[model samples]
Target chain A: MRFEVKNASFSYKNDRKIFEDVNFSVDSGDIVAILGPNGAGKTTLLKCILGILKLESGEALLDGKDVRRMQERELFKRVSYVPQAKNTTAAYTVRDTVLIGLAAELSVFKSPGEAEEERVRKVLKELNIEHLIDKKCNKISGGELQMVLIARALISEPEVLILDEPESNLDFRNQLIVLDTLTKLSKRGIACIFNTHYPSHALQRANKAIILSEGHTVCGDCESTITAEAIEKAFNVKATINEYSDGGNTIKTVVPISVIR
Target chain B: MVEKKSIKILRTVLLIILPIATAIIALMIGRIAISPKDVFLILTGQGDMVETVSRMTVISFRLPRIILALFVGAGLSVAGCAFQGLFANPLATPDTLGVASGASFGAAVAILLGFNAIPVQISSFIFGILAVVLTVLCGRGKGKGMTMIILSGIMIGSLFSALISFVKYVADAESQLPAITYWLMGSLASTDYKSLIVGVPPILIGILILFILRWRMNLLPLTEDEIKSSGTNVLALRAATVLAATAITAASVSMCGQVGWIGLLVPHMVRMRLGSNFKTVVPASISIGAVFLIIVDTVARSLTASEIPISILTAIIGAPFFIYLMRRGGSFR
Candidate 1:
């Protein structure tokens, strides 16, 4: 499936325009990283794609179908979303949390059957969090919780997975874990769109990068398109793009040697 | 593992047995002090005491009131549990949604207008439903959260309460004022088989509906986006469940004035023991609430020559316990 956001724009009631004429597309097995500084409407753009927030103009199309016109359940079946982080208000075990993802497949009046349980167990095993099945989600480590949440998203077997800063709250190890998981999911033919602050992670896993500045996509291409000039222009920071010995590049914010004095 | 399983089984067994024992105690040790043997005899139908005072006391007055207490208690508690789940707030109850106040306003209006007979009950039911509808409509959100719902409920409840007060002020002092005041404090004193018959069906049906949807109630606290992404229609499910819960609450309140505490405290108590899963919590609330109210009503009738309002006794008992629970973080999920 292909998701195409066509010239979409949105502004809040406070007259803060979050997105303007932002157009992007993702095909199956593509890892698209939306890169932006704080307040660059990275979250807003994701919401627009998920149809949680309405576009001021234009539309988001999923395989030639307008997302706005599609029923929520239909859209949900095709697109899975993992929020940045959520506070567990009630005590739900890891298994229970993941089982909620099977809600769409079950009848409204009926509980999840053996097949659903089997699916949930399979997803848990796939995520390698099978040991955390009976553990409380709130009491678990951040990486485990992230994996559990990803497991929840995968339970629906969605074609497209939209993750909002999956690495935001994690430490370096967990960040790598999450990024590796996203890369693995992409390899499984799932189109993964995520937002990240760290550009190197995107450069490592994303086949494409979208840079948003002031609610507009200033740059949308592979890593080569996200140059030092674009970074300086978008974030108003002077940075040097250095080519690593491993054929990878790093955009490091530069300060003059005289500033150290 | 075996010990843990045994403990769980023991807890479950205790949860069932304790309530039954309390109900028996409530029935046996009432104002008349019926013996356990007599109680058994009266229950079984093989009894020489049928011709004597035992039959009249046990069959007519005590039995119905006890039964009323059980049903009213269970009904209100179940309704409270549902409301709490619906609002996703531990503090929510029928009164929070203005159903009880609306019922009070309705009954007060009926009394003031001298609408005697079944029409008064109908009027109460109408007002109760109307209050809940108004609250939900006023509080319904485009993007606002539970705060709007709670604020609307409070605003509507206060409005209805003010209206009730206004009606009281204008009411004929000799007849209506005392009646309104008495009703406001709440009582199961006037309960009969008729009101019980009218009341139990809706409560049972409402509880059944809630029970059927109990597992889904887990979805209530989740944000709209989360719920939608999980493949549930948040709006449709919320509307249906809220309406059903409010209807049950209104019906229960309209039947019996404003039997406070049972709705508020029983659900909390249930959650404090059982987990917050509505599947267990709802049924636990019903059973515990039934037992609690039956005992409270028994004390209300037996403690004095004349009956005290069940609400007063419940408030006296429940208020302190509620505060204690709140202080101990018992209500937090």
Candidate 2:
């Protein structure tokens, strides 16, 4: 299925545009990475695509239907969103938190039944977080929490998965683990899109990259699009791009050499 | 997950049976003690064997007071649990949105005007609801965060409480002043079947709605953005919950004056035992809260020749227990 954003534009009050004429799309099995410096409207673009924010112009379509016109339940059933981790003091168990993600499927009068519970357990196992089912959310570490959040999102079985900075607070090994999980999900035919501050991560996993810079967007295949020139232009950094063959696949990494104004 | 059937059964038994047992014990222990056999006989329609005064006491005084206490406790505690979830704040209670203070001001105003008991109740109920409506309106728009709703409630509560103080100042010192002061401190001394008849419907209906929505209420403690993204309308759900909770809080305050701490303490007690699942927590709050207030009300009546205010006894019990819970540290999780 085609999930596309066409020339979407948005602005907050006082009218300076956060992003203008931003356009991109990801088909089934495509994993897209969104990369930009801070305040680059990366999160804003994701919000717009998720229908959380109304676009000033243009539209996001899921399977050729305008997302804005779809009911909230229908939209969420098609697309799932994972927000960045924050310190939550609520004392929900990991199972309780994940069960909440089944809201789109649950009728208002019904609590999560045995089938729903079984589905949640299966999703937790899929994300390798089965052991955390009974653990309180506040007791979990950051990486574990992110995995739990992803499991929460995945329980919806959304065709398109959108995540905001899934690896932001994680250590290096944890970051690789999360990124690897996203890549695995994409290979299973769920189109995955996530924002990352680390360009090297996008180079490793994303088939396509969209970089937001100066109220505009650059989108293309990751191999050609996320270049040293693009990083210099988007982030004002002098960076070197290195390539290596890791067995059967070519790996790309971006190393910042110096800061330009 | 393996189900702990024994623990679940024990909790259910304690919740349902404890309150009724407490109510019965309370009925027997007042100044004029009745034997358990006689109390049972009277309750079972065998009052013909009992003395006149004892029969009258059991039916007219103790029964209604106990029933009203149960309703007030359950109403306030359930509302407190819902509001805490809505605001994601453990310390939040029924008065967090100004309903209790507003009801007090209305009762004070009615008292100042020499209104009868029924008029005072109606006035209090109206004003309590009005206060929440005002708070909701004041908190509308871009800054519609939980903190803003709470701040607006505080502002409205302060306003109503100040008005209550002003009414008290102008009241007749010999009679009306003392009555108003007693009411403000809270009591169920005057509660009878009539007041229960007036108060029970709204409280029952409100609690029923909350029970049906208990599982959904679990979502209230999460981020608003996450809630909305999950296909639930956060504003609509919160507004409906607040309205239902407020109806019961208003009804309780009007019936029995302003009993405090049941709202705040009972929910914490329930969470400590039930582990924060609203499905269990809401119902548990009802029974536990009912038992707690009945016990406290029993002391308020039996401890002194003249009845002591319920709020005093509840605060006396609640504050220490709350401190103990906080000290326990892991209790919150």
Candidate 3:
């Protein structure tokens, strides 16, 4: 499956246009990142593609059909979303929260049964958070909660997974857990699209990137699109990209030095 | 959160049995005290051991009130539960949509117009729905829909309350004023088979709808954008919640003035025990609400020779108990 955003544009009331005619596409087995500075409409761009905010122009398409035109069941069957951890602490047990992913499959009058429960447990196990199934969402750590949210997005068996700041509030180890899971899922032919503040993360995990800079937007292969100039321009900072190697593996890191005037 | 099958069955049995057992006890000990044997005889159509006056007291006077107690209690509590979830605030109650005040305003107008049981109920029902409709229309704007809804509901509630006062001001003090005031106090005293026939269906239908859609109700506490990602129609879920809750409240208030506390109290008590799963909460609110109201109603009629309004007693009995529970129980959130 291919998830594409074409000519997307949005602006808040009385403000200048946030981003205009932004375009990107993520195919199966691909990991994509939407990286930008604060107020650069990175979240806004994800919201537009996910159909949370209506695009002032252009449309989001899944296999050539306008996503907003698709019914929730038909559309979400192909695409699922994992929102930021801060916005999703509903006080349900972890098992019940993951069962919510099947909302479109069940009728209004139907409760999730044994079959659904099995799927929820399977998904939780895949994320290695199966022990947290009976724990309430509010009681869990932020990192565990993010994993639960990911479990929910995956329970639908969607081909396209979109996440907003999936690891923003986590510690280093948990960040690795989330990004590693994304890489693992992408290997299973799932298309992963995420928005982030870290350009190094994009270069490290994403094969393709969309970097929203001050006036120019760069969207293509991560190595070329996330250049040192792109980082300085997007974030208003002086930065450099450095690469290290351990045996056969090469790791790329971007280090920021000073704020630009 | 997941109980064993046997334990779940046991809980369900207790919920169903508690209300029935309490209702039977309530029937036996009303104004005319009757024995358990006689009450059983009357219920089973073996009334040879029962006197005519006792039979009338059991069959004619007490039965309808008990039934009304069951429906009104269940209706109001379910409405309260729905509102709490829809607003995602624990403090939200059945009156959040102004249905109680709206119905009261309609009843006040009808009383001033010399209307009795059926007409007043009809008027109250219509105005209750109308008030929510007007609130929805006024609340449409460019911000969070729930905040706008709550603000508009408050304004509409206040508006209906003012209208009710205006009706009182214009009413004939000798007859209409007292009747209106007594009605506003809220009692099961005037309930009979006739009004029951006219009033119970709307409340019953509303409860049925909420009961069927109970699983989907968990989504009510989720933010609008959050709910959208689930691919469920949040708008329809919200509309169903508001309309069903309004129907329950309006019908209940129209049937017996504006009985307070039960709507706000019962669901909280259930959530305190069952957590926030609507699958359990909705059904528990129905059964526990019925039991709670029937007990209150029984106390209201038997404790004093002259019937005391239920609204007065619910707070008198409920507030202290609620506070105690809140203190003893862990965080309600």
Candidate 4:
């Protein structure tokens, strides 16, 4: 499966241009990490790709079909989005929250039946969160909430998973856990695109990195795309890209030392 | 799991039995007291001679009030639940969009203009819907959020409330003023079979639509961007929910003046006790709200020879119960 954006442009009220011209694509089994500074329109770009935000010009396509023209059910069956884990005030249980992912599949005016419930159960079990099936979401920790959100997104079994800053609120261990989950999902042939503040995470987990900076974007394989020069260009920070060996695998990490004009 | 199963079964049973029990107790405790045995026989159409007066009293007076109260309570509760879910605010209610205040303003105008009962109800219903429409229009934008909707509702609600106060200021000193004030305070004393025939259908249809959309309603608490990503038409869904909720609220408020608390309180109580599942919350709110208002109405009628306004009793009961809930720190947040 392939999802591509071609010359997509967007502007807000008063003609404030967010994305001047952006282009990127992801094939099945590829993970794309979006890196940028705050307010760089990273989330806006994700929304444009998800078809939640209408483009001012150009289009996004999913598997050679215009995403804007696809029916909601058909489109949702192929692409799932996991939004940033804002603490939802609604006290839905873990099962209740996850079941909503399959809403497009369920017929309107009908509740999920036994078969659908069984599927939800199986997905939660597969995610190793079956024990939290009945727990109210407000009671869960941030890391657990992220896992629950991922489980919700996966319940649809989509070909493409789009996540926005999936590890934003997570601690070090939990960040690793989210990255590990994305890698495993990528290995299963679900194309994953996630934006992150941590470039080290992008270096460690993403096969493809797209750096969105100054209304322009650069997309390529992770190693060449996320260099110290690119990091300096995008964030205006003096940084170094270092290589280290961990358990017989080469790992690249970005270290920021100072701000540059 | 086993305990949950039993609790689910118990809740189902209570949902069925509570309203019936409250209705029976209500029938027995009215102004002309009849024994429960007599009440049962009279209701079943099997009582003879001495029960005839009692039977007429039950059917003509008490029964219509009970039926109207039950439906109005159910309608308001379901609308409240839908609103709470739609705005993702636990404090939202059927009247949050100014339907009650607008309906009161309409009723006050009707009274000042010397319109009769049916015309007054029609006026109230139209104005109630108008208030909500004004709120929606004021809040309309590319992607209006919870804060905008709530803020517009407050604006429209206050406007109508001020209009109501103006109507009262100009109303005749004795007859019209007392009548308008009493109606504004709320009571089921004037409900009859005719009002029930007119009022029940809209409320029932609204409730049915909301129940059918209960699972979809659960999505309302999610962020707007998240809802859009879920692949449903978020704007269309939100409009339908608002329409359904407004229909019930307008109908209920037109028939009975400003009966408060049931709409705001019942849904939270249901969520607190039974979990925040709209599939369960909608139906549970209906049953519990019906019972609560029926009991409150019974108390209103029996506590004094002159009937008490239902709005007062609802606050009297609802405030303390809600405080108790706060102390317990139930699902309210």
User: Of the pair 3 and 4, which is ahead by TM-score?
Assistant: 3
Give the least accurate 10-residue stretch of model 4 chain B, judged by summed lDDT.
Answer: B324-333
**Candidate 4, superposed: residue stretches over 4 Å from native:** A87-89, B1-3, B47-50, B95-97, B110-122, B133-155, B170-175, B320-333
Q: Rank order by lDDT, top first?
A: 3, 2, 4, 1
lDDT by residue for model 3 over A136-173, one digit each (tens)?
A: 99899999999999999999999999999998999999
lDDT of 4 by residue, A20-88 (tens): 667778899999999999878889989888877888998999988888888877898789998888745
Q: Can you write out model 2's per-residue Cα lDDT over A27-145, one digit (the tens) per residue? A: 99899999999988899989888888889999999988888888988999878989887644468888888988898888877788778889889999998889999998888899999
The weakest ten consecutive residues by lDDT in model 1 chain A span: A252-261
DockQ of 1: 0.45
What candidate 1 gets wrong by more than 4 Å, as runs, is A13-16, A86-88, A113-118, A215-220, A243-261, B1-25, B35-49, B96-98, B116-159, B325-333
What CA RMSD would you report for each candidate? 4.1, 2.8, 2.7, 2.8
Alpha-carbon runs more than 4 Å astray in model 2? A87-89, B1-3, B111-126, B129-156, B172-176, B320-333
DockQ score for model 4, please? 0.61
* Interface root-mean-square deviation, candidate 4: 2.1
Tens-digit lDDT string for candidate 1 (A55-98): 88999999989887888778888899987665543566776778
Per prediction, the TM-score for chain B is 0.85, 0.87, 0.89, 0.87
Q: Please give the distance, in angstroms, between residue A142's alpha carbon in candidate 3 and its true position after superposition.
A: 0.6
Per-residue CA lDDT of model 1 for B20-120, tens digit only, reads 78776776776678888887888888767554787677777777777777777877888887777666666667777787888778878887898763565
| Candidate 4 global TM-score | 0.93
lDDT of 3 by residue, B1-333 (tens): 356877888999999999999999999887688999999999999987789999989888899999999999999999988887877756456565677889889878987998877788778878987987776678777774435666787789899999998999999999888888887898998889988988899899999999998988988887676688788888899988888888788778877888987877899889879887888999999999999999999999999888889899987866676556445542323
A-chain TM-score per prediction?
0.91, 0.96, 0.97, 0.96
What fraction of the true interface does each of the listed models get right, in terms of native contacts kept?
Answer: 0.46, 0.54, 0.60, 0.68
What does the TM-score come to for chain B in model 2?
0.87
